[model samples]
Target: MKKIAVILSGSGVFDGAEIHESVLALHAVEKAGATWHCFAPNVEQLHVVNHLTGEATEESRNVLVEAARIARGIIEDVAKLNVDDFDALLVPGGFGAAKNLTDFAINGAECSINADVAAACRAFKDAKKPAGYLCIAPVIIPMVYPESVKGTIGNDDGTAAGFNGLGGQHVDCPVDDIVFDEENNVLSTPAYMLANSISGAASGIEKLVTKLVALA
Candidate 1:
């Protein structure tokens, strides 16, 4: 069986991982007959936000703990992730991906990836394992892999420009489609980046999981 390592950012869409995207990815992976393990960095989130009001909150949370909510408390610290044991890696997008995994939300093209997160992704890259990045998670791809790659986060002009500036080629895609980087064995999809509904996001995510499994 192909084992995939899934990296989560946090718990919510505003402050952490997009709950829907995270869950959808998990569902697709399982339905494809592949097992997966979840992981997250054991570090403080950049900030907390109220999902209802979309305002900053006084609360603080750890990335791993919050991410655990999505994994149903079954996850590991990203720092200890052994890439050799997993056939592929997958990242679900939310603001948490930007603020926690990489500073792309705040720094855009100049964003810096969290050390542990980058290390985990790089380990898979070094082993030549294929990976899938969803939503904004693709922004950090250039940091983990040297080759200029193709990816997508919907068709937002400014965000796509950021990917280009960071040594990646951002392909414009709809929520139900995927951008495949053949040379790098990487797959990326828009997910909630353009989806107006959960089913819409599922289309691309499911395709990504199937393709990733094949690559693995």
Candidate 2:
């Protein structure tokens, strides 16, 4: 069985909606007959602030603390394992992963810009092991390959502007629709949306895992 790593942001909500993308992706991976591992950063607990108001409130703090605890636990478990044990790395999208100061977001950035994560990703690529990402998780690609020959993919508005600071073309299909280049160097998909449904998310995951296994 191919071993895979799935990364999730600890935050449960993003843009007023709960992030069920990662959970659904997990289910799909299992169905694909791959061994799955979960990773979340255990960054320092932070107080949640309203993106619109920028106000600090008790409710926000509590919520963030809880998220951090969960993210930390996941990361701790993954970090203990040898990366060589896994055939590929999978990153599932959620608000927590996209938001800064959290595990998913922080680690995603690291994997994108940091030399270590980049090296690891490159190694995985060289091995022909399939790496999977859904929803906003594709953001890591641009971060890692800012000026590569590969094109971007996601929920962008055609002009490549999507999410808070990310840019890519808006895809009409489910997040499981994997877009890639001839070299298989670039993989893109849409997993999360502003007005998303749980059923859609679940369906997307099933497609994503199936596509990934086929690609592998």
TM for every model, in the order presented, reads: 0.98, 0.67
The clash count for each model shown is 0, 5
lDDT tens readout by residue for model 2, 1-216: 877766554555542113466556666777888767665443432445465575644653333334334334444333343567787677666554455322334443233332333454555566667676666656555554334424333445632443224332333444435666436444555656422677766665577677776665
lDDT of 1 at 36: 90
Candidate with maximal lDDT: 1
Stretches of model 2 off by over 4 angstroms after superposition? 15-19, 45-81, 101-123, 149-153, 162-176
The TM-score measured for candidate 1 stands at 0.98
Candidates' lDDT values, in order? Answer: 0.91, 0.52
Candidate 1 per-residue lDDT, tens place, 79-149, comes to 98998889999999999999999889999998899999999999988888999999888898887777578
